[model samples]
Target: MIDTARPPSVDPHMSSALLLAAAVAFAAPADDLDLTPGAWPMFRGPNGVGVGADPLPADLIRPENLRWQVDVPGRGWGSPVVADGPEGPTVYVPTATPDGTQMDVLAYDLATGEERWVRKLFTVAEPDFTHPTNTYASCTPVATRDVVFVHFGKYGTAALDTKNGHTLWERRDFECDHFRGPASSPLLVQFDGLSPRLIVPFDGVGEDDQYVVALDAATGETLWRTGRDPEVQDVVPDLRKAYGTPVLAEVGDRTLVVTTGAIATDFLDPATGERVWRVKHGGMNSGSAPQVLQSPLGVASDAVLVTTGDAPTSLALLATDSDLTQTKGAAASDPALAWSSNAGAPKRATPLLLSLGQAVTVDDGGVASMVALGSDVDGDGGEVLSRVRLGDSYWSSPVRAGGTIFTFGKEGAATTLETGVFRGGADAPPELKVAHKSTLDEGVWATPALVGGGLVLRTEHTLRFYHPDGTNE
Candidate 1:
């Protein structure tokens, strides 16, 4: 559990409460577990901290240097997200049917490639519409030491024992149009001294006011439920739908919950569902993750970074709430907005806040560039890492480990670069690149899952693993 801030509200323009809770659960490939070391446990990983201790080879890994590939059952766009469980580090994979009807959750041993268990956690006779490029498993699963939770939107949510595939409990009554089927993944964090809390964001179809839910991870009990309305279910375009996930971070001793979706990026109280402050980015659709970085505490209590724009000029920066309450028109207008950068921002992929004040962005057309982090970036004068054409359009957020950043082409072409200051060791030579890479077939929209010194790459048809020492099995 993390100790939140103990300060009072500097501004009270919004409500104060952590609205979302956890949903859905998944299993990894059918294999003995051997997760990539220092891997991701949930979306954006534990506490939404993009910072990782991943021991990636300074050199890139190429596809021709084959490791081991395993065809996964069913199909999905969700990536193989991993977590350390009672069974050591295990991989939790959420899968969907080709027709997008049947959704399955499989847990695999991270070591030897073997199916630990595959449980049909939930099924929707009919599914909400998702992009053809999207998967019914768009949202990744959330897990703790005891159980893994999966959010299947229209199909409902389920919890499974990490040791075996036994479902500990499930709640299938939650309903959401998910506009394009749920893409916001579940987030886990310690709250009120209990087991880390489960936070889930639910965005229905058009004009539907989205809601955030909090749940007890062990018993599947509802703790709190907060939304954008007093209970408005209208389907206009007031900007209520969202595809982005919620994140938790403390500011000045207070536990502030930040959720970035379609219309608004709101800040709430982690202890309760109270809106402290909120800023409306006012976009029709948003598809990226929110990251909080070290910065001066004021408008946002911290610098909150997000990506927007099918074109450049679509990015913006705003603050999260310090207080939690829905009653607004209060004090502190617009909260705090450090700044927003529209320069070369990724339209589909979430931008990476890199080292040395630089942020790496990849456009929908596969144009990659490293831009400065300050909101006042001129976009004219700065070091341009690479302006070359890469893969087809991409949805996977680039991965940064140590001083190197890794972005995978939609076709599974992995590109690694050395960013700012070295967090692990001295910057490796530019000659060092992606040592190994491969693709199952189709483009991999699902982000790669890192755990236990192993990387699990998922395509629409198969899931593959790459271990250290250039050996994969």
Candidate 2:
């Protein structure tokens, strides 16, 4: 149920004012520096690591604390993105009908949950088939002050004017099968002296037909395209597909984009789409996005960590070495592999990299594990610090805010734990203490958006906002 009572702190007429102001400023482009402090502007916030400075409500299960809950028109699995607007703040998400024919991008006023605009951008006569768990609107929207980009896999990809909800450009030339449906989300990379580019992976089931494409963000022109050949072993060919999103990592003074495909993970130069290094993992069809671990002092490690997809899931760690970095071939037998653990690898949700040098992962079965990065310790890397069971099943990825780690299950339950100690010696075990628990009526599959001292969570049929006390503002 939703609380109809209006809060005294916010004006009810603010929604209309926000819409008007947003319309006037739709022509200007937004950058990372333009985002508000609490804004979550991308897939995993700005950095794509699911970390925020503000804390969520300790008890979101309480109905009274829910600020508002409004029914959504269609189904979607993509997470919402928040940005600062002219009047206040705005939220954007993509949804589609049950038949996968109609695709729409909806924008809402962050203050009152008022629908600002809905743009019916594309309609497919013969839509591709998707798995029962996936929806037609699975890809999340990427937004800036000037425009918002929405992608429906091979169906279509378009840029919409942020102010009036108008289509700026459209592209449908990319060839991809998306055997079980597309899951990779589009990413934006801003360059210093060049136009900003949108990067997305096209790893479909193929023999030699995979590509990592980069497009000019302003005009939707192809800037560069590079091939990706995982050379997967003989198995179900459909398993040769991947549904993971690419992430940006800072290595020394250079920046690289790290992407996981069917049978391997590759690091490429963001500007030219050149391969920096490649590491082969045994699994096929990787769904979890790769995470670059950071040390306690805030330095990013050269090694990247990810969970290999499919049965008998394993966690693989790949680091840059002179020999492997110099060669363009796959590093299946490279000596830079720190460790491989098969304990609790997730197939869908992305892992959380902690500031305390611990990597927290939640598998599809709702089992959570904390592993030490071994940067400060003397033991072999990839040691399990601790483990716990949160729920029966989970699809939403875990996030960190303030000093707490939040995990959500598919059955509407959420667990809050205090970040475990990161400086424990090799002999001491890492531990995360449970602090609070909460729940909702509908199940969750999308990651929640946190900003403006509040949280925006999307269930199967509703979008709800909450205060820190789990109460409506």
Candidate 3:
């Protein structure tokens, strides 16, 4: 629940007026820097589906395969985002001081691991306590050609010029009591007739404060603010907080904002903040973002895969056009509930959607499993196909390049799995095999980005770029 009675320090009216004044004299011309096949613009690339077209080297752990490595200034867990700029392609990452008082975003040259610029955005007088495994800068940024948007939970959200790293606009009035820390990254979406909007979620454990807000991308002006369902307020405060990110999905002819929260997954109209449909999974502390399943027939299924954080189960909810609701237990009776699984469901890492109509998930304990997504059109639930033990803890979600799946362990171990061929037919089970395994010097919690035929990764204290050979293309 958001504390509506507490007055914000910055008046919304004044903030809007200042933003309008600055836009007239100094706003960069918006360009078409939309998500491309080569750019990793957001948390899990396009549509939150973690797959890259470029093929990484079979063995990336060998020292000779390293392209370049650089020591980052501060600590952060947010993954690096890559975009093409006038000079060349640039990598943007967020970091902060150990005390969490100072936060900044660092830009580096994609070709060579050289620092381009650093923009310090916030200086908090008193900071809150973050989880031991989490950092002050856990929210990954979203980028375009002209501007990059970064969010630091309750501290603030700001937009910066991509070329020179200058501030375009900032907003600090949003309120939330993130007891552990903030990890939900913002989403950028543009409808056919609507302007580009940055959607930010504030699903903290505070009272009357769990809501989602959309801001005009050109300027930091609030367009709509929608609160969570009032029924969520009835749960315990800890059960109300969530750290999952949002993804955009096409349902029929309309686009919907599909997001996961404490007890439910919601589908909302992107143009308006109205709820279109919802499914209650009866779980808390959801950390994994929802993933849309694509059928083997080369079409999007009407079901989305979701996980209930800190719970033992994950679920698949059927997407519909009506404003109806269903529960996880209703799978036996309700057609809206497609399936549910308790084997190797992730608590932090988002599941990867495979091409063979199967979903792969790595639990926080380093257990990975493959589950079949039952026919979404027929309302059938699936079962766990296979399970494998990777032998190390994982917080970063896995990404696929070509036929190999990359899993990052918290202890700095990197493992690649070869998705064996389905010899029989398309419906045959997959033969999972471990391809290669290697270890790094430090722990890594940030997900790596694949771009320009190279992999960009962030560990505890440094950022490294790796390619097949020790040369930058």
Every candidate's lDDT = 0.60, 0.71, 0.77
**What are the models' TM-scores?**
0.79, 0.85, 0.89
Name the top lDDT candidate: 3
Model 1 whole-model lDDT (C-alpha atoms): 0.60
Best-to-worst lDDT order? 3, 2, 1
CA displacement after TM-score superposition, residue 374 of candidate 2 (Å): 2.1
What local lDDT does model 1 show for residue 466? Answer: 67
Of candidates 2 and 1, the better by lDDT? 2
lDDT of 2 by residue, 1-473 (tens): 11213221221223544423322232345443232222676777776788876866556446776777778788889888877655457788888997888888988877788888899877888888888899888787777765677787877777777666787667776678787777778777764544476778877775643677776676565666777754553546677788777888776556778888777888877777767666777676676778876444242345678777875477877755334333424343332555667766788888888766678888899888887665421226677778877875888888877777777778887787775445576556658666787776778889887776777888888887766555434
**For every candidate structure, what is the RMSD over all alpha carbons to the true structure, in angstroms?**
7.5, 10.7, 5.3
Tens digits of lDDT, candidate 1, 185-298: 777656455344567777665443377776656555566667764323433643445677677765555667787755567776765656766665555356677767555411
For candidate 2, the 10 contiguous residues with the lowest summed lDDT are 1-10
lDDT of 1 at 342: 56
Write model 3 residue lDDT over 308-404, tens digit each, in one string.
7865456554544222213333333222655566666888898888877777888889888877776643444457777778988998998888877
- TM-score for predicted model 3 compared with the true structure: 0.89
